[model samples]
Target: MKNPVPLPAYLALCLLLLSGCAAAAGSPGSAGPPSSASSSVASPPGGAHAAHHGTETGSPAPAPAGPSEAARMVCGDQPMDRLTAILELKEKPHTVSNWADSTFTCTYHLAEGTLRISVQQAPDEASARKYFDAMQALAKDAKPIEGLANLGFPAYETADGSAVFQKDSFVLHVDASALPAVAGPNAITRNALAYQLSTTILACWVEHH
Candidate 1:
């Protein structure tokens, strides 16, 4: 079943920006416009092609694996330890919810308000991309986030301090009710914090991949 996104009020301002990402993803004619050029290789110039006639092509890279049981124990079922480290929160998350499916959710008490993080496992990359596209359709007024492009996937942070992205077969979300007045000693802003948290979770996906 397709999950309908119910974005919070703060995210309304991001709808316009993300709509394009979704549009681009769903466009049949668009395949690799924004994908990094480094990911592809150019064909060799030759008067006649002989390498393809009888040469053996190498095996493709292995398919990414699902999240590990250790990951489920560390973050999926109980994410407080991980969240606390990233947010520098004084108090651990007060709420935890592990759904009937593999969706793991946690809510933390912050100085300004609440911060919620949710992680859900999709069956495969296509399913994960479908959700990422869905979330992009719900964003507006977004700007390209710097320094996060090397995570082996497209990642973004919204103007409203929310971040959403997918890696492997996982969809990760970080939403803050309000940005902290002053980031803890480490000086991580709400948006950067979201990106950081997502990266950490994506590492888990990579480990199993």
Candidate 2:
């Protein structure tokens, strides 16, 4: 070799070469420096989030059920029709019904008077018979209605023109004290009308049960 290079000049040349290599590595033509990957994510469409979380979006709950068949029979349209036919009601009577203490009561308000029907449901047949016997014993001159024997067990007419009878665990009473008088002088009596109403109700019970 010719002349030896100075120490300072040699060190400067090495630093310049290192800087050029770094710039070339960062350029568009070369691979980029190390970095973290993208961290973003996309969501699903249309209530998919709710479905994923076990929820039904935009839906309503179901409705509750109505009254029982027995309650409807004791206080509904069939008996009303029978009352109209037997009493010859010119106008539709105003009606009200209630249920309490295992009993159902229905009252019809007419222009001339009121008609009432009551049904008591006991726990067992023995309890119903006991109650029926007690009612018969308490009636003011209770008389067994031979004609209504087919209607209920030991049917009877009360002193106040009502009919009381028992069948199975059911005790029924039809009070016709204020029924309107029919056109004929020999029209059916109130007691007979009570019996007729009881017969209609018993037929309904038999049909349903």
Candidate 3:
């Protein structure tokens, strides 16, 4: 059976369609300025690329340059025990015996360029933790190192060359002379770089210990 449609409803729908056609015909083009108009409606605000323009009238906005290399990295894991052993380079082949041998990396971005640092080891956590502790002590007694005091990648876990944290702070600062295969803008940049690397180390320590 065919259902009868309400007259008002049908008429209103027809009027809306007719109105839209009339409006388009009478109105000037709504297209924006020619410079750029964000073509893709679905793209993110700062998307790297613009969307399809096949059916569109707008162009995509420019993508932001965004953060540099240094800005991309964040602080990560290395903790007390891991810090000590790695810094000290204790037990060479053996390491702290608390973690496994692996590769670690740190990167820094400066107006000059990006500094990438990589540290490779073949030892257990306990040994690496020991080395890390010794290095922390040296960094403490070592001169202010000029601009690096701001970083505050302090010495942790004292005795047994173990790094201790006054608070739960998990950071480490080092110089190129301090750790091989790590590159940074300057000592400060390196310190920041070290801090990032330390986080990774700390993660390894946590897994093993």
Q: Please, what is the whole-model Cα lDDT of each candidate in the order they appear? A: 0.46, 0.53, 0.27
RMSD of each: 17.3, 45.7, 30.2
For every model shown, what is its TM-score relative to the native structure? 0.54, 0.61, 0.23
What TM-score does structure 1 among the candidates reach?
Answer: 0.54
Model 2 C-alpha lDDT per residue in residues 73-115, reported as the tens digit of each score = 5455566765676557666677776544445567777665777
Worst 10 residues of 2 by lDDT: 22-31
TM-score: which is higher, 1 or 2? 2
The candidate, 2 or 3, that scores higher on TM-score is 2
Stretches of model 1 off by over 4 angstroms after superposition: 1-79, 86-91, 98-102, 144-150
**Which is superior by lDDT, 1 or 2?**
2
Summed backbone clashes in each candidate are 6, 0, 43
Give the winner by lDDT. 2
Off by over 4 Å in 3: 1-109, 112-122, 137-209
After the best TM-score superposition of candidate 1, give how far the Cα of residue 112 lies from its true spot, in angstroms: 2.7
Clashing pairs in 1: 13-140, 14-139, 14-140, 15-139, 15-140, 16-140
Worst window of 10 by summed lDDT in candidate 3: 22-31
Predicted candidate 1 versus true structure: per-residue lDDT over 6-27, tens digit per residue:
2232133133222211111111
* Model 3 / residue 120 / CA error / Å: 4.9
- Compared with the true structure, model 2 gives a TM-score of 0.61
